[model samples]
Target: MDHAPQLIQERSAPPATLVIFGASGDLTRRKLLPAVDNLARHGRLPDQFALVGVARTPMSDEQFAESALGGKSLLDKRQLAGGVRYVAGGYDDPETYKRLAETLDELDAVRGTSGNRLFYLSTPAGAFEPVINGLAGAGLNQATETSFARLVIEKPYGRDLATARELDGVVHGAFEEHQVFRIDHYLGKDTVQNVLALRFANSIFQPIWDRSWIDHVQITVAETLGVGTRGGFYEGAGAMRDIVQNHVLQVLALALMEPPVSFEGENLRNEKVKLLQAIRLPTDRDVSEAAVRGQYTRGGTREELMAGYREEVGVDPLSRTETYAAMRLNVDNWRWAGVPFYVRTGKRLPARLTEVALQFQRPPHLPIPADQLTELDADALILRIQPNEGISLRFGAKVPGHSFRVRTASMNFSYDQTFVEESPEAYERLLLDALIGDASLFIRSDEVQQSWRIVDPIIEHWERDRSPIPSYEAASWGPTDADRLIGRNGRKWRNAS
Candidate 1:
């Protein structure tokens, strides 16, 4: 059995001010603000830390605080409200940017938080350029000896490869590569990072991690709910661009990358970039054979009816958008040669779960009779990423009662059982990492471009092919074609349920 990971004490972040561009947006209320509050509760926030909210909506600091951190005692509300301020103006206006700079300067004096600034672009993708340009105009993107300036941009970085490169150029103009942080909350999950710890820190798994011992890998990110009101946004970004392009690909890199010489930001990311570069870019013929796309149809009883993709609000009746995607990929390098890495993601599936499973090659010889081992399954190592974060090792074992009958059994290690304190939310760990200038968990510019390079061909192929998107019931795992995509190779998706 693998030993549990050692617990580390939390450290406080440096004194700085966090400026949010879309403070009135849903992300702020649902994720950002709550994460900050949780950090404060854990005493991970610096004493001089402060927040400055900038948005087009006109509102006082008091009102903004109430809207963001409401339903608290007066004293508790006032404590967090003390360090917050709000600025209102158009995102493209130079005057608004000037006011933001002045506000941060004032907070530096009043709150004793140096000129250190961490600007968060929580606005829509369209607003990213204008906001970055405005910050540059105000000279807020530069760093000094005593203070540092970091910019955190949210994802769906661009529509495709061309757009992603253009956006990178514009962002590089305002801030140097070292000062920019491209956040991917998936990396913040305890289980996701635990993958690295499992391979590098342990002695048993590392030896058999290469192609000689492993057969194949599967990564699945499924959702239990549909795009209720974000249908308009979902139309532009199908599963390939939204999930596979960024989150799913990043997970793949972590699972397959070579161990770095050191765990420093640059050293770790360098190995990941190399792994991504090694993935074979699917050819036109491979695209048709290796890719599967789908949309969901209505299902369930009338009283509990589910809406189809076309029936969702703000979506076109004849939309060709895909809510589900599955693709088979291969890394052409020595370590992973001939091993297929299958990845799939979708909405309105049977359950909400994210996981990576490594299926090992079956034993070359079995001394027992085939009939006695009828219940045996291929040995697998599953790393569950959410809901119940744990590591499960599945292997065949002899049945207790009798004559050498073999059955599959699992040895599980759960985070809740191993550690006393709750794991930090993905956003919380990501936020603190940004504040402290540790870019190890954040994506690099080159890493982003390489991922886009791998995804662009598939998007183009799907467009030109104009393949009819298959449909499955709202709560099914996915379309049958996805099953067939893997089934053709004499394999199947792990029954995640």
Candidate 2:
């Protein structure tokens, strides 16, 4: 059997018109445009392709194309003359939608492009409903005999379960289930997909990837930047809603999911939703003991100094937002029962990183020295999701020139060293996936509701109590309580790079 790691399989590109709702927004210019450019550069787009950028501001197609493709690298830029256009309209403005609908025809006439359109809801959450209604009103959401129409929504699906359900109603009213792409970019990451490959592609891991051999799992996404320019947005959406609700939860589900019947896209997503559903809600006692919410205060480490969240632009001075959250979660099923899954995510910490650590159970038969137990920590399977995308395994190894002293050493599988190519960014991957009608990376409607159900109670508890969220230093892991929450279990977060 070949023990080689595999890359995400590339498939045929579909010819479709791409539309961006918030064309002037940062996400559109920074991610959407660049991703499209990359797709074009890779020769993945069809000759009949077109892009329609819709926003509240009116700008010429040349102006909009220049704005969208302005700072993109040369490798990402491609020739798309007469293949892109801009349609200015408010999210709730019916007239704007009509104009955009008309522009689709104009693009088709000029480029012989099909009527196929993928509408990316690049606008903020508040505008989601209005845009959906606007599409419906403008008759742009209909699937004609000649073409397909798809709607792609950005993350932060909702503030809670109720809002999510409400948003679901608004979106479902305008488009069918398959046409609505609820994208969670994390799923598009080459490394995230590799999690499946690392387990299934290798025979060494599957048999031992259970509660019997695995001690605990930790998924962390730490960011060094504070609220910054997104203070207004971050204030309303703390770390929990902003990151954990979708990104962290998706990562957790992927980590905990059982091996799917097949490695196909939808099959993987079906398994993911099941794993997510298996997560037991935090009880009152669990919340009191296992959950931690923290805010970053004014302090500095030896390396760098930083301001508190309140000091950021657009943030309320008396902001009650949480920059850090740590919780002990569990899957009530037999596979993960009794094994605590510790998940922590934060902003304005020591670094910007994302990783999933699977700590395997200690050896049932220990022949090593008793004093070396700390060094004999569980065999660890570490998958770095960002900074460096790779997999590392840690196991007990004999110390150099020593008696029987054993230490853990990492055997790594670095993607860059092996593949020698940059993994396409998440947006590019997801965009290409959407164009090909792959709904695997996007969230299923039910999955969105289930995530909200799990998080709804925590939000309710925080709202009712108005408790004082603990503060941590700018360049520290998090509050002291967050450490203790894990320490009491006799386990600590591994020192990660």
Candidate 3:
């Protein structure tokens, strides 16, 4: 018999003031504000909480609140909107820091926030150092005897290994490692978090999760939209830095990490760091064979004509930047010593999808005749991360009736159908976690450097090679070279079409 789901109550976050660095930007409106509103609706916010917005745009407190609310009524319209305050100033200006410090002190006294603060760096990557230094110079980085202070940084953490290390130094200088929260929204997704629960919370799958039973693992994050107006940023980042380095690699670490002693912040983060460190760093020759890069060209229906990446506004007419990337990574560890993990991400693909798939080895002996079992294939377990969040298992099943024939069949689980409540947005979970001082889903400094180390060789090799990169049609899967990358190992990418 089926049982009703248990309801777990979450504690409200302690009183604090959330100071957003890029409060005037699109991300603040589209994601940050909406997330905070959602948290209030869910009763996850404290009565003494306050919000402060800091940006160069000049606006009064009332004006900032109006702009943030966007003419929509919120669950806690009075508390949410009335608590907002704004400070307009340049990130690098010490005067700006002076105003910010004064604003924070006023809020702490008026709102009973107790000096607790969560500084969110929603600004561009270039502004990180200035913001960190600004907070320190203003004495905002220190926690009082009865209070706490923390920093939440957005990604594109660094362009490469050396830069990542340099940025780490700057951040560490102002904030201790424990007070820093390096956020990747992908880690906050319910589906992504379920990966750990699916393996550790369940005993049925743990014993066979290693090299002996699993043939390979595939992690994909695909997007159907082109660069649009962000072509300038895309050129500098490309697929590797923008997606693979942080999102894709973080998901891979979570899916493969050994079980933590407990799901606490330190234990979970330590396991992920170890898993990332185990990823084998590819060599010059390995990069040539295992990494494939491609750009998207003009190809779509006549009614919906698409422009090639090179033709996008702000992009070089002959840009060599990659819109697509696929790679085969090997983890040199005891459990996964001989297993391969394939990862790929791209823009202008067939669909917007993100998933992790594990293919199990075929049965040693199928007693059925080969011809009758022609439809049989290796079993697979797929964890879908977006679009349609779910888990699916594919295995052989008897084709009804005569001849003992078999074919692939699936058993599925959908979050929408199974859960009574809707899952919160990624930003909501991340923000709340940061406020409550939980770093389990946040990335650690060692994890960032180690991930960069794994992909640095391939990025360097690509930069040195000036040859034209392969191109795929706008509505297609990817370049033919990507197929050959996995084909060399007698495997193929999962057909998401």
Candidate 4:
């Protein structure tokens, strides 16, 4: 007798049609389709399912599907076998969406989806309004007893607070707040979820989690590759909006949030919102003191490989775009009042990594001699989110030698070392959540707006000042000032740590 859960066997109530508005775009080919396919391959997707892709290109459904999914032979063979429906035309044209709604209907005719649909806004930021309007104008949002229409939007949700709020208004015109899913892919990481497990599930860490015991928290997301093809997008977005406003801040929230009452979507999101709200928005002086923005010039480890930001294709010759950003923020609450949470992210750095390092201060006074205790350092609890996935705790213990001295040691738990089979990729996990109707990892609209609110003033400060924002080597962590941004305060960047 099979004992697997019924939900694992039965198709979810969600109408299983994934309608991609910009199916031909880079994200669809590189990320969305693959993520959806991974869900299907792992049996996380419902059996009655269809993917309807919308685009401006001149291609038949077969061509669209083939171009996007067919070229994915380089990926796991099983995942590439998933099928999808593709519909192409200008989203600006209402007739295109009329045709897309018809395609959803046709798929429903056979699959018994009963008008249920998940609309993915994979198009450009400019197209968000038109596409959203087109869907409603085409009656795609019409409610029925059995049919559910949900919207899943890609990020760069907006460039600033006003724009993000305006975009939310536009999306809300077609779908209610409950129907909207604003995904921040960083939240999908296995290690990001593990952060909660490490803190809440285990009793060992929480006791030392408060300001009295913890010194500081460092959340960093670094990338080794420069903006290549997305220079057009990166030039305007910059590192702050690209990483911090959404990804890095979300990571920070995961690291700093109070234990959720439960793991349900709304319950978890409530804690995240609270953590974000607790963060004191930077004052002008705070901006001047706590923030540093930088760009990359023509220096890298390989002399022949140097390429400045301006020299990159699709970038302005005098672009003030910042590829690197670092900031020190204080959450204005009793738990983290005195502790500064340092955040940083950048492109074309030494390597690609995302980590949260919680540094614990040294003992108030070591009874042992300075020479004897010199080997002991501040304890750091590190959760590496990528490149390698693991948790390490640095603590002091008695040295093996007869002499009475303390030495730092690392207690390590690596995902690879423990798991026999593959860990589900972040995309795969996130796609499954969408299928199961979970938003624990997805940002709420208010969260998105608040993030933009916290970030917009920094954008304003840069626009008005227009200083050179300093440039660093392509392969370096960031500009020299970034080092002093942390070091002057007796702290150091984790790359150095």
Candidate 5:
């Protein structure tokens, strides 16, 4: 096994034309184009880079460019205007793809791109297959030895294991495993990458990273707002499919994956795949014991009333969809055999934060008197992923007094305070990685299936049971059962505040 890590080169990708399938969509305007602009501003974009927008709506290249980057400075607008071109056509039409292929070829000739291409499927999930098949039918899936072609598929890969596998099969028909990039923007966060750096780059933590010293790991991705205008989409996704399956699980893999021999794309991804496969998948009975699901109810004063999940604009009156979910998972492996991994995510919570906290076991012998230990907490290391980006270590310390009264004190390191430069947004880093052919931050097909495999049974159990879904208040952490899920194990969930 190769374990030698390789240094990533800080170089721009060769000239390529990035084709976004849903160019007229909200994501294109809000995230995609802005990310590209940021990369260009940083001098990271290839000199001959180009963008081709494809969508059903008919618009001229100038109109599409304006819609995507309209508010930019004069210089940026001029530079973007020349590289951006639009092709208006339906996703299912073969002729549309033919025109798209011709457009790419023309861009290659005019822009000196040398036929390199990246196809980004920003369209709805339903359009994924048709778009993939359309590209394969148009002979755009394969690249010559000197050139390359890659595809970036956005999330909600499938509803469940079977569907995920089917989607994988469909994707493979057009692009090889190496040619596909399954993007999860969470993996691009500076704090997330910091997890790997903090682990593998340091000697102090690795020796205690496994079962002997660590008691449990908690991963939380919380949101304080309701579904809002996305209630229709939320009805089908909920917290499990939306947050847990993709985002939370991926974070878990990062926290738990063994150090790879190399940071090469395949080597790093292999360890993550192993971590997911080693998850002690929950049985039907295990689901009832280890998992808790809930939806948020109304809260706040009359003038500031909030709506419940069912009361959301597009939700069903009696929807069983879970807006909040918590689970206790165990990984059956040598390094983490007895350790538990607790993950929870929800909307309308007390705050919007994403974090991972590792609670270490108490010392074998507490020299302090039992009375003096009342105020002390177990040693903890927290990796804060959002809102405030930082790492904090909590340890017991003596209160300033004659008596040895103990209380926890935090030693903190914050990205904002410690660094002079602002970290780029997640989308910006992910887009640049895709452009440069770095698959390290993206999920692979097998990793997706493995995650779904762990959650599918729990989803099934939740569906079969007729019991009413639990509820929490709009601004609370989650359902009380989530407390019990960990409390039963003589532990408790960490507070985001």
Candidate 6:
């Protein structure tokens, strides 16, 4: 009997023109354009693919291409550059959509895009409604009988639950639920997706995955760098809105969701929504007890002193915005009942890491003497999502000595060592998925609302209190309060190191 894994091939995206509304933005230069280039290089893009960039900045097609290429002489990128077109217009202006519709038509004829369109709203949040209205006004949202029209929206989906629902209303006004892709880049990461595969594909872990065997789960997304020039943006969107509301919550849903019937877009997203809906919402007392927020202070090495969050450019000196946030969440479902999920994200931490760690309960009875197992640690299965992406299982093992001493030992699997093919960037995978009309990795509307529902109360509680936000050293793990938040549950935040 052969036990080897079979190679499953992915189909290339059909011919389509991707229209980016914020082509001049930093995200476009750093992620979107490069991701498209990578897709073209891998032959994942259709040969008839075309790109139309729309921004307020007025520039010729050649100029936009040069700016996008950023002087990179790669042949595939240059070829992609060849088909790149530019339209200069204001997002709110009806005339802009008129010009954009004309541009798409031209691309269909010149580049053979087949009238299939993927409109990407990388623009500012304020522009989302105007752009959607403009698209609808231009009749661009209506797809031909033979082709499809989809919209890809970037995050900070809304400031809060009310706003998110409002944005959904606007989005649904122009496109159907199936045609709207709410992009949360975290879901595209190889390790994040692996959570599903690890849980469902393996028979060994399924039996012990519930509250009976697992004690808790930890999801941490730490960054070593400060907000820098993005302090302006970060001011309005603290750690909770920026990370926890979307990325952190999305990862949590994936870790806790039930096995879906199939990997279809709706099936997977439905499962995620169900899991998110099961999360116990935080009340006033729950927020006060289970949540902690902090701002980074100047406390790096003398050689590399860092500015405090308040001192950052464009930030108010007395800014109450939290650069760090830690919270304990509970899923009130049968499988995860009584299992607390601790989530934390921060900037200017000791290390840059994104991981989900599941700590198994200690054995009910140990045959060895208590003294012999003093150094033994609980077994933990960790899924590392970034910066040395891999998985590791830490378990108690016998020492290599005469004594029956036991210590924690890890069995590790590194993506770089195990696979020759490099994992694509998150945006690359997500962009290609959007182009291929796969919404499995995309966020569904209910998923967004449920996540917001879970976090909205805590945000309101924090806003009502005018207390000073706690502070942590720039390079430290987080505020002592964060430790207390987890410590109250007899747990501690797992250090990235």
By lDDT, the best candidate is: 3
* lDDT per residue as tens, model 3, 303-325: 99899999999999989999999
Error of 6 at 421 (Å): 1.0
For 297-410, candidate 1 gives per-residue lDDT tens digits of: 997568888999999999999888889999999998989999999999999898899999999999999888999988999999999997688999999998999477999999
Which lDDT value does model 5 have at 372?
Answer: 86
Tens digit per residue, CA lDDT, model 6, 110-158: 8889999999999889999999999999999997789999999999899
Give per-model TM-scores.
0.96, 0.94, 0.97, 0.93, 0.97, 0.97
For model 6, the stretches where C-alpha displacement exceeds 4 angstroms are: 1-7, 73-78
Off by over 4 Å in 4: 1-15, 68-83, 302-304
Query: What tens digits encode model 2's per-residue C-alpha lDDT throughout 52-89?
Result: 88888879899987886677642444557667789876
Best by TM-score: 3
Query: What C-alpha RMSD separates each model from the true structure?
Result: 2.9, 2.9, 2.1, 3.1, 3.2, 1.8
Global Cα lDDT for candidate 1: 0.91
Please report the TM-score between candidate 3 and the true structure: 0.97
Candidate 4 achieves a global lDDT of: 0.82
Candidate number that wins on lDDT, 3 or 5: 3
Clashes of each: 0, 0, 0, 0, 3, 0
Considering summed lDDT, which 10 consecutive residues are worst modelled in model 2? Answer: 72-81
